[model samples]
Target chain A: MRKDRVLNMLDNAEDNIVERLSVPALTDNEKERLLKMSMSKLEGMSMNINAEEEVRGVDVYRRPRWHRFVSVAAAIALVSGAVGTGFLLKRSGKKPEDSFHAVVSPEQTTELTTADTVSTDVTTELATENTVIPGTSETTADYQAIAVDLMKAMNAAELASSGMLNTDANSPLASDSNYFKIVDGNIKGFDFSTMENVRNFLTDNFSGKFYEQHSYFIEGSDPFFKEGPDGLYARYTGRGSIYGWDKYEPEIISSSEDSFVARAEYEIAGTTFQVDMTIVKSEDKWRVDSATSTLSDPDANNTNNSNPYVSLCKSKIEDKWNELTNESDNVSLDFVFNDLDGDGSPEFFLMYGNGEYNYQIDAYTYKDGALKAIGNLPGSHTSFAVDTSSRKLVLIHAHMGAGDYSWYTMENDALKVIKNEEFEYQEWGSNEATSRQDINYLSKGCIYKIGDGTVSYTQPECPINEIPRSNEINSFTLDIVDQLYASAAE
Target chain B: MTGNEYRRLYAESPEKAYAALFKVYCDYVYAIVYNKLNRVAQREDIDECVSDIFADIFFSYKRNGEDYADLKAYIGTIAKRHAINSYRSLKLRSERFSGDSDEEFASFADDTDIETNSDDRETRSILISKINELGEPDSTIILQKYYYDRSSGEIAEMMSMKASAVRMRAARALEKLKKSLAAAGIML
Candidate 1:
């Protein structure tokens, strides 16, 4: 932001504060009323309303909402681990249903782990896992300095007011920019792919502004400093709707204050997202970066079940010609589904986008499938993902206009992620999980609903055979993958 | 910090949680209710909802203990949603008594005279100001979506957008008002 404009916005904002807000002291009657309104539901909820009956009985039972409202002196009582569980969830009056429950089930999940780094928080607790920043070895005074530098890189209003944000009318690259990238470095493990094949598969299957995107404008210190005083970039770009496929850009802020992090309010898609960026210095320069932003594929915890269909598939593929569109000057999307020949199957894939978030994808499946991506406005075809689960073909893409992931499964004839659950990639580093010593996260992951379009999440308890194993990240997600792999090996 | 220590504290006194919750969320709650429920003449109700959410949060902590994950995220998510739910749900329920219940609720957008042919952004800001006046979830969801540009699906998961009917109702209420109010040449 121009220094003058920024200062002006701030001044205007300050002046408007009073007219916009009026603080009133709570009266006796008002306090009583507030107390009742507050506890009516909480009194019943203090329990894991969604937890299993047996689990709820295990001491984390429902408590009266009024009980917790004591003064701060009383608040110290809640410091206990066991007692704290009650506040996690409120119970429901309805009788037991299926018994499974989850809170804040985001549509996207990311995983990042070095091919050499081994397991993760969800997997084993690496004996030498460095979760904290290695450089913070000094005392509190050192951290204070680091925090101060972070504040220097702050520039949120500028990003929020950028032409792209104001409207496509001003976005220079609105209709033409298409490039797929995964930026990762300073912070380890924060990496993902910009798969054109996956997005193309989605475009073919959807109609009416085929994809979606959830964006954010964060002002934080750069984790990897290149020179001078590091500044936080107006991180922009879009992510696809496939729960975890979302992209964000880095818009550099001008400052030398070191690393001070402040999240601008970014509410796109149906959910609001706040990116937490950590700052660091390298090569005598200050820069704002995310711990989980990576372009390279880390060691993949993958399992592909393939077979003899290769011979026939290869022959059929050799028999057909592939079509490619260079229509997008900077972006080109091409894909040949291994399920070639319209068969209901998925195989090999390839493609590309114009830039940080301009993309196109086309998937031809012998598996009896086809895809179509319709772009309506700016940020055009950022990036996307595709997978066929539960007989229904699921597609994920990002919208240029809205900064949120759009989920679509072929319905009738049009592809639509008309539900909020369909959006993904709420925030940068949302999936970026790092150890205290490591500069970057070991991996990233997102959780989403698969059945009945309802949220049902599973943490990869046993991320892989190499993980050292800990109960921390595991406690957050279900390890269905680990279970499956274990059973399959058996 | 130990589990037993925390439990003993809560057992010794329950008000501890309420006080704690209040401090942690005072700014946020005040911002939401004051902004969204502004038209709600019952200042008592607005105040009640704020304190209630905190009290409820404290009790919830005492009831359902969580040792891991960011505590602020956990509580904020629940509190914000509850506050909004109460405002909207309460308003809807009160309307069931349509006959003589002193229906003084006026259109928040009644004051706006935005141009009908205004561009997307012009229409967008008008919607934002009106929603902001209504406060909380209405403003939260609208600004988060239209202003920030989030999808409805993402919103649904973060919040209990609940039945499509409920969401449709909120959307209809918002969209209709934005559309109609934009035509208010004088206000625009």
Candidate 2:
């Protein structure tokens, strides 16, 4: 055994003995100092918690009210059977190709007829080749055709309502004073005169089973419709918006006598996903039974072909890597991509460090079609981990016995600190000293030893366990970075 | 404080609750931190650790939504775990700067045998009992001088005595303790 080991054992034994004996008391000054420190920290944490709660409250209540308006507009457009394409184009100030149009203009209707004839010709050719069932082919074709028409109707309704649905400004529905009413500068409730319109809209498009499952327009479940003495009035429930797809091109995946399933490529907000629509024949008319959407492919949405900013950001990071590696052989550069701001576009965190102590994190995000540096944090030892609960990055700056933990969030296209906690060594002194009194008759030859006036020392105070366990970014080879970018581009 | 009392206090006023909690547990937490870190860390480090423990306790109560049935046990557990982590971190850092190998540090962390641990505990118990027999300021002088590694002058200041007197008492106490241990068939 090493001599140090035996000494360590003795030290441990002494500590155990002292603990068993009695606990030492802190001076009143020390107690007061610690209490003050603790209370200050508590206050800071409380502020952070309150801020988070406020943000969540806004997300839950404020944003959903706008979506409710859009839902009502879509229902109204569907029942009225009016294509507001021209109005939508005028309101959005967007060209036809920039937005989605389910129903083409009168000029394009002739072209659509020719395309439909071609589609019929192709089906006939396939049936002649015995690719489809002999007797059920016609019925299958009819179901598929009906499914496509219904999908188009749904899409047209969404497109028509998109123009009139304004969360920030007064909706056009508010102008129809007979059917709607406004209160407190918001579209608060619908007039009782609109009850018949609401009933007809719900009865026309949805099946009984759909109503049972969704309860979307019901009085009790949705809280959107309430019965009063006069009639049914609308209530504004703060349930957030449901997004509508820009386009859905459907193909029949399966067919039966009473029902058909159509899988469609649903595009929305510059991203493409898949949705399965179930159409069933009810009361001699086909209606949408249910539609389930699949998760979008992130790679498909983030590809260089789709987003030019991705490649730009990748190139910028590569240039930085080369510059860093050129400076020192022992330097390391690593990066991880995350959509910290929930804006669909991912921001990259680049960790640059020397082999020993010096480290830094440089955050870059694509803004205005170019890679822009958002923030950089430098320290002797700096690392970042994701706080999954709050969805923020916790940047840790640690050194020997002192460090800072800063919670970072992307706000207004820049990285900002939400909370910061610091721990460091503290030095304190006690001036308590023992005093001796000389007797008046004491001889001059007598001598006495004096006490040390003060005792002081520095001690490390680290709250390692207080930090949340988070997923930390680990460095990999530059080749892996290249591979990541290449795969994303592909 | 009990968990119900704390919750009630927190509901009434969070600031006052935090103050009450700190006042109750500050000394207990400081003792644990100081005991764990005294050999390796400085006074400020211990102070900071104590404050951090209280802060963590308050934060956890507010944010984690855990109904701590035994608040004292909860506080003690947090204090002990945090202090241990701080100790390991400081020790590892000290070893790194002192040019020690990783293997040496690993052994230092893991090499305590059961037999050796039991023997050490028994011997320390006996040593402490015999030292107590030395009585009064002598036992304190000895403990402060040898166990705490304090200087004679500091021990004198603490005991309200002359430095020379503290040193003399510490020496005599050690001699007496050594004789008592020998009579019990134990060697220091």
Candidate 3:
């Protein structure tokens, strides 16, 4: 074939042809530069890959490669003036080591009669720390800016450790630092223990949704600037009557932009409880990252499910329900405390379920210092959700494959059903060629005529004009109904 | 280093393996890329292509695994592909800069002396002289095919001839070259 001739020509081509056509090679300088660059790039990549482990408090000895690389990088950063090494070195009271692992531990609750604020020596030392400052060496007044930064880190660690702020696992207190030491001490004065102090501290310090699985009175736009008492903090105040602390103080254990820790002590009933608080700086202010308190009593712990208040509420509901129903076996009670009517008071949403046969949903609002049942609905399966924005309560009950959505509103101290809709899935068409399923929604509207004490329901073409009907009864489901009602309210 | 040495280096120290590979193959890759791009790309661009070729080699090992039947062949293939890509991009960029449609650019670009700035003076001159002796578009076709390693289809597009005609012309030119080389007492 002709291909054989072409192949023969290609194979017979002299090796000298390629040798003669060779281009110039790169110089030694270029090779060295590229090799160094590649090594640095690999080092950076490894650091990024192991950043999570570093954040989780893994020791340096475990990651020898990372430790070696970080030591070089940190030294380079210091010498190149990328990070201020002056303050970091000055606080250690010792020469800087290659590893930078000389960490200071915060002392236990040992009170010292020192001023609450940092001293002038702190300012002078911080001034030198900020080498990035213009015009070489700066004065005391010039150091004020970075001083605020250092103070914020200190305050963040202190407040976080003292249990005055919210804390989580991501708190900076867990970070290893060499400069500051967090010493724990409890103040047993009424001034520091007052509900006013706690309210001011929480309101001023916390931002956004710090309370998890807990609700607070959020008036207008900002949750921080509420008009009335905060619900989550009320447990520690006279309003909720759960528990109160005489004084809690977080001592800055050690501080840095990278890491911070605090030793906190809380005084309650002549007993001083110790806790380790993690602090981290956020947006120029120090905040509590997390906390570990030493409260062994299960009852004293608010996080405990077996708390007496919850148990009493459970017993009160169960005792009343047993007296009425005479049913006890295979029964369970669950509750959610939330403001259902936007009235700045939490209403207990209680559910009583007996295996798969009976389910009762109830709403109890605290009035006159006692829990009063505002509404009740019973079915095979049911759910209750409140749209606080619209002051609407949604109750969905499904039985025998048919479900009804009943919307209620607070009227004259009682939850009155305003509108109700019953929906069920039905098969449509005859053959497989043209078969479909459709949702048969029977809508109703409540009307109260003048001078009539009773309300009557009338059929409506579309109970909710905006809510599009589908073959799937998504509202019949618990979570979907809650979301739908929330979206409607929004 | 051999394949076994490379594997050991990769296992012990990946950075060291990368450096060793670069040292062993950098010049080979540079030569391949520079020759391919001498006409279309600048010296700086060629240098960048050489660096990119090695970077591609490093990443390929990362992506496809470190196992290779022939490391030299793998590196050579990457170099060839990278050079081809660079040549194409440079050509496209020049065409775009000139603001010419395909037809206009091809016609205008055909007049350009392909080996004007080529290095390897003695070898290029000998090839150019031999190709010139073939006469008219036949010489251009031979140069494009053998020297530049361009395909017949691309030659056809540039010469405004059918791909089949271009292939036929190339085969005849090669036959002519064989006869000419034989006359000059050359074997291949």
Q: Which candidate comes out best when scored by DockQ?
A: 2
lDDT of 3 by residue, B1-188 (tens): 66567878888887788989988876677657756565556566777787776665565454324455456755664565456456545654554445465453342232122122223344344554565688867876765566545578776776778999989999898899768766755544
Supply candidate 1's per-residue lDDT for B147: 28
lDDT of candidate 1 at residue A116, scale 0 to 100: 18
Which should have the higher DockQ, number 1 or number 2? 2
TM-score of chain A of 2: 0.35
Position A450, candidate 3: lDDT: 14
- Tens digit of per-residue lDDT, candidate 2, span A275-315: 67788766877777866554346455343444466566556
Residue B115 shift from truth in candidate 3, angstroms: 14
Sorted into a CAPRI-style docking class, model 2 comes out as incorrect
- Show the colliding residue pairs in model 2: A64-A240, A426-B44, A458-B42, A459-B42, A459-B43, A459-B44, A459-B45, A460-B45, A461-B45
Candidate 2 residue A376 Cα shift, in angstroms, is: 42
User: Of the candidates shown, which would achieve the greatest lDDT relative to the real structure?
Assistant: 2
Candidate 3: deviation at residue A413, Å?
87
TM-score, model 2 to reference: 0.32
- Standalone chain B TM-score for every prediction: 0.46, 0.62, 0.54
Measured against the native two-chain assembly using Cα atoms, what DockQ does each of the candidate structures obtain, in the order listed?
Answer: 0.06, 0.09, 0.03
